[model samples]
Target: MSRGTDPYVAGAMDRRIALAHEWDELVERVRRLGPRFASFLAPPRTQDFLSAVGDGTAVLINVARECHALLVTASGVTAVPLPGLSAAEIADRTERHLTALRRTDLAAQRVHHTQQRARVRKVPATYQAHHAAKIEMAEAQAELDRTLLPQLAWLWDTVAEPVLRALGSPARAGAEAGHRIWWCPTGLLSFLPLHAAGYHDGSGRTVLDRAVSSCVPTLRALARAARAPETEPAETDKLLVVAVQEADGMSPLPQVDEELRLLEDMFGPDRLTVLEGPNATREAVLGQLPQHRWAHFSCHGRQDPLAPSTGGLLLTDGVLGIKELGARAYNGDFAFLSACMTAAGGLSLSDEAITVGAALHYSGFRHVVAALWSIDADTATALTGDVFGSLTRGGRFRPQASAAAVTEAVIRLRNDSPAHPSRWAAFTHIGP
Candidate 1:
């Protein structure tokens, strides 16, 4: 009964050898089909394909209760496991943070209203009530901090630190200047701010500190975008700048004019097509989209939680829903959605990839810069101007330089307004 020539073991080994050969043949066929077609085929879970992507970038895919950090470099890929980080927990924390943020915004508004009332002529009877309300708001905020800080710390420990460690701690001393990461989060994790996840333990351990963070819906999307054709130079490229300062019943954004003016100056008047107020209608903007290589939207954006695909940019006539964009094929390469919730997704349908930014990507824009929440008008203008300026300096346009340029611009804004995450962290680059 010696096992030296066991028939069962020998047969199993032969089958495995044959399967290996079959797999190699399949892979070779996919390679000949091209990157776009090969993307549809599931890649092997091993590190063999990492060489096909860019250097110094890692792609983290979060799923269910764990994260798979695929460290991609010019040489190879390495998978790092991040366990015990459940999607449910991430979602709960995100919702809690958003609630706290809304409460903080309301408190600020109340304080401003009280100040306006005081300026007019405060009544003695109402003064005591207003002061009491302010105190109550402060106490509520303190309570919220007690709940929020711990969750953020947990995320840093469980999620961000592991990913950074896998990427060889790009934040460490003497690391190269342009380290980048593309986060492809699942479920509610997509809505959470992965870039800002860190504890406030006096140690700068945040993702923003470590690397420039960008997002893509899938690894396939990132690969596709990386291979997309380059846009024409700014001098020759056509840009469609749409600003809906007043759209029906929505609040007007007068600062959009400033954003448009800055963009016009950079792109030059002949290269720019300006659409504002009544002219920035749904049909008009959609019609003009195919003719331009770039588009900048400075208007209100809405997210429909009930039907996520219905969410879109609010134009003068109506909403330019994702459904409409899906029907068209445009030649645009970049889209800057300077609007509220352009990157936000419905909690229930978080995996649908239906945000305005995603829609623009589907509509053939290789790169999209969008907001995760409502942004301050002045902050948006400043950030956009700096980003585009960095891109077009020396009269040369470099689309490949966008990620680093955006990170630099946001860091500058963060330095100026350190306490306000709403101003800096809200905007995110959503593609290559």
Candidate 2:
């Protein structure tokens, strides 16, 4: 299983082999008890069951395949299929079946999880090694997805299909934002162009920034046009801020305190309220909603596909996990998330649901706004200031206005110092 000419390849190959060993153990247990006779069959005896199946050694090792298929299908794994055959063949089939299953759904989850975990934190020495191993892992993952997950999906479809289908059925219009903090893991943020957004890595921040500048106005106008007549857009709500930042000391963006104060003054301090952030949970935030329809924030937010534990928003004294977002119920129509990685989600931007915008939309806010990529704080703060300032001047907060305000603000900031054109151009508005 560890056969490889290259050392790096060999190490990765060794990991797969180790996985096989674990699979082998699972199979051996299957052969001893048969598939239908899973330890869960008798009762809560995984302990005694595991011990009883011991000593099969080679024979047990072979059963891993069929056992995998049966257990995966059995749901809750109460029983294993009892094929009318000798123990050795049973073991072999179980092992082989598992090998096949491992080649499918379980494999895909494993691969994605592995890659996601690897990306959780970057390590310099492990960088090259990781990229190289990723190729191998991707191959293995592909083979497993192509081979195993389909079969498992079929099995699930055959068994629990009805219940699952009926359960996720969404209602008309869309799911209500009923006081619950909606969490779409891996939500899309923005579509800004790279150079326009500025990046130290020389990546596509410009392309992404341009996408933001170009799209924000269009989306904002579309939303306004789509109004249901019950609500009209706000002119003082012109701030189309797209901020991506982590919480500092478990608190929302502090640099924006001055800007937020300015907004309170312009939009009316009574019209705005700062809910939970670094120290608050989603549940705490939904306790109250903006009856006035507009709101702003200077907080921390995170979106990571593989690390939900590390994903959350900053209140004041603590971080609110996205997993717990469903607890908060939002009633406001418009909102903003000045947090980091708010829009990052699955590899495909569209499929990602972790952005604050998606959460707001899912919760009930019709004209939710958001950001896509990471942003520069001072620049973002300055742009946001311009936005509120424009809105207070009665300029419509439509998509174009929002976009123009953000862009022009950045332009003005840069014009103030021709040498620093890159500073204020990092923020963009993601309109709904």
* The best candidate in terms of lDDT: 1
Global fold similarity of model 2 (TM-score): 0.42
For candidate 2, give the lDDT of residue 353: 45
lDDT of 1 by residue, 1-432 (tens): 357878998888889999999998887788678765564456544343353356656565556545666667767767778786766677678778667656755674565566556657768756765686588667655655565556556767877788777667755421125357777777777776676566544466666666777877766667657667775464427779999887664556767989988988887878889888899988899888888878889998887555777788998889988889778887667788889888887767887767888888876888888887667779999988998998889975555677777777877776685445566777788777
Instruction: Compute the lDDT of residue 121 as modeled in candidate 1.
Output: 75
Residue ranges of candidate 2 with Cα displaced over 4 Å: 1-227, 230-254, 276-281, 290-292, 308-310, 321-331, 348-350, 395-400, 413-422
lDDT of 2 by residue, 336-379 (tens): 55555454443243333444545554454444445543444665
RMSD of each: 8.5, 22.7
Clashing pairs in 1: none
For candidate 1, give the lDDT. 0.73
Q: What would the TM-scores of all predictions be?
A: 0.78, 0.42
